[model samples]
Target: MSVSRCDIPLPENFRPEDILAFHRRDGERLAEQVDDHGLKKGLLWRGLPSCLELRFQPGAARLSLAIDGAAAADDAGRLASLGRRMLGLDQPVEAFERQYGAHPQLGRLIAARPGLRVPQTAFPFEALAWAITGQQISVQAAVSIRRRMLQLCDCRHSSGLLCHPDAARLAGLDADQLGQAGFSHAKSRAILALSRDAAAGALPLDAWLDGVPVEEISERLLAVPGIGPWTVSYALLRGYGWLDGSLHGDVAVRRAMQMTLGLPDKVSQPQAQRWLQDFSPWRALVAAHLWALLQAGGF
Candidate 1:
């Protein structure tokens, strides 16, 4: 299969590590799947033919981004719109900086990488399902379960690439079937419940966006049978690009924060909540940055 490539101006001071972290969270491990090479700023990947690649570059007044795929030329405008939406372009970074400035660690990191924004992933349902798959398990174990579930429920394109299983298809599954896909009882229940809700239009995954209040959306998300605080927060950050949402209960985030800030132990939930006061409306960016810090061995 022939490969194609393109580049867009990355958000000013964008770090490759941040993009790679977002891609990892999105379950797009092009680096692992393809024999490819390039800087994070202008990434290039070759995978199963016709794979989509997206990037964001910060601009003076707005963000500059690029999307490359066999279909990219036709989808440039849509891709650019998606990029703007994903990077929280609608929010003023200065506002976020003012609120979160008290945290020297977070502030320093942001300074080092100005105009840094959390890149959003496209697959919202997949993201929710993956979060459930990851609950209480090691990252490797989560990946294994996700692979099994996708293999059982997802269909491969003509080019041999797998797309996320559709809501209808997955909604047809029972707990037994999901368990066979390596999900535990709870995880299986959660995924099926999520699929059913999404399939029935109870949770309108597509319509949720940055303009919506994080707390409000999270409440609705929690109404789903298997969704919880962590899952809802994860979805907001990764699925909808809400810059102020934080995974306060997330073990990794807690650990990363403690280490980054030199706290002796993980911040308590209340403490985390208080900490978030410094990052309101941009807590999501702080969460992304902390996650990146963890990935980079800084925490």
Candidate 2:
């Protein structure tokens, strides 16, 4: 496959390294390689396995991009769109800062990391799959299972990088197949059902990106078995960049909140919900900041 190349303009003062650091947090991930300078990951574009390499152009406000294995002639436009979404170039960080910069609890966090932006999955289904894989497990354990799933799918680019399995591929799997990847029975059932729905076009994961009502989307996602507030919120955040999904049910968010607020005990889900309500409209962003605070040992 021929390599397709392009240069994507970066937002002013945008630190691509921040995004790289987030991707590298759990150590080297399968299907992807992350370094101090860039990320190289395999993606399924129109069900075609392709390797995308993004390198930051030092001292320049642009990213040098190369896609190996994409065949479309007009891949540049697709590349730019993917770059903007994956890099969060379109996130309204300034608006978030203006609204919450002086927040008593989050003020310091915002000041500390003004360039923070939520990195999104290349596709919504990947986010949904990740949310299901990560349920009730430590991040490291989830990463292990995800790696196994990728290996089981056996989708790879010519360069031998694993590609994240798309819905059709996942929908074809039985519980036993996923069990080998360490998915519990309940999670396997959930993933299979969701994938089948997605592959059948019953679930419009892509359409939801087009200004769907958050409540409506949340309701639809909740109707799926084994999916709850946390999974839906996480999928929306990473999949749609929807920022206010009430992530109070998240254990890490609660732990971060407890420490950030100087509480001796972790706050209950309901309590965290009430406290996060004050942040409204940006609750997930607040959660991101709290996670950053926890990561930085500011608590």
Candidate 3:
């Protein structure tokens, strides 16, 4: 195994530990591990199991990364890209903060957690698959099912840590296999279709990240079997790190909005949608803040 290391600069007030904690929250033992030093995650680099370690100091302005395993020594460009996505470094956080830092509804929340970000999966297909798994399910249930699916794929690094399975590994799976991992029939078909489409290059998953119009990407994703507005929006948010996707349809978003608004009645999807429209390009970022509110015990 080879080892490669590099340091990535961070923007002012960017908090790497918050990103670390988010990844740690739903960590499946085999796929990744997180602690004070930083995150040690298993992933596939060039179709080989590789380990990525991120180390940083509190209040530091940079992150140090170490990539280990086969083909790990070179590929500086790919590893840096992966690190940025994993840390949400490409997000227009400062822009969002500048626009909404003083807004009445979100101002306080943003003030309390200035470093909040919408953490993304390492791969686009991973986000899509996770979105399918989470459809209409409780977060806890989704995590359990996701852990099971990871075990089912069984792609492990040389260090014996399991890597998050890529589209090809997932595409080879059948409905029965997914069902055994707690996927409903509809979800199984949806994930299988998404995996096959991605693995076969039928879906423009990567291009969506490369400046495609959001409407076109949304339309394409919505065309897939069993994919709905919520799934498409969520995949766009988590996969592309796009902050504009409307997440009002999400139950947690509505619930958190209700709490933020101090409303006695539940915040309906339409009501939340209308309210969130005010944030426009930052709607999803606002939604992320509300979700963080709930996670931070504000609800």
RMSD of each: 5.7, 2.5, 2.4
Q: Where is model 2 more than 4 Å wrong at Cα?
A: 25-29, 59-70, 296-299
In order, how many clashes per candidate? 11, 0, 0
CA error at residue 24 for candidate 3, angstroms: 1.5
**TM-score of decoy 3:** 0.92
Give the whole-model CA lDDT for all candidates, comma-separated: 0.60, 0.81, 0.80
Off by over 4 Å in 3: 58-74, 296-299
RMSD (Cα, Å) of candidate 3? Answer: 2.4
lDDT string for model 2 (185-282, tens) is 99999999999988999889987877889899889888888888899998998888888878898788899899878899879999999999998898
Better of 1 and 3 by TM-score: 3
Candidate 1: misplaced stretches above 4 Å?
Answer: 1-9, 24-50, 55-76, 85-95, 98-103, 210-215, 296-299
lDDT of 1 by residue, 1-299 (tens): 33334344444544444444444532454221321222122212211223344443343222222323343443445545555554455446666666656666887766655666665554467668767887766676777676777668644443345545756668999999898988878777778888888889887776665356667778887887777887887777667766666677776777777877898866887787678666666766777667666663211
Ranking by TM-score: 2, 3, 1
**What TM-score would you give candidate 1 relative to the actual structure?**
0.75
Model 1 lDDT at residue 259:
77
Greater lDDT among 1 and 2 belongs to 2
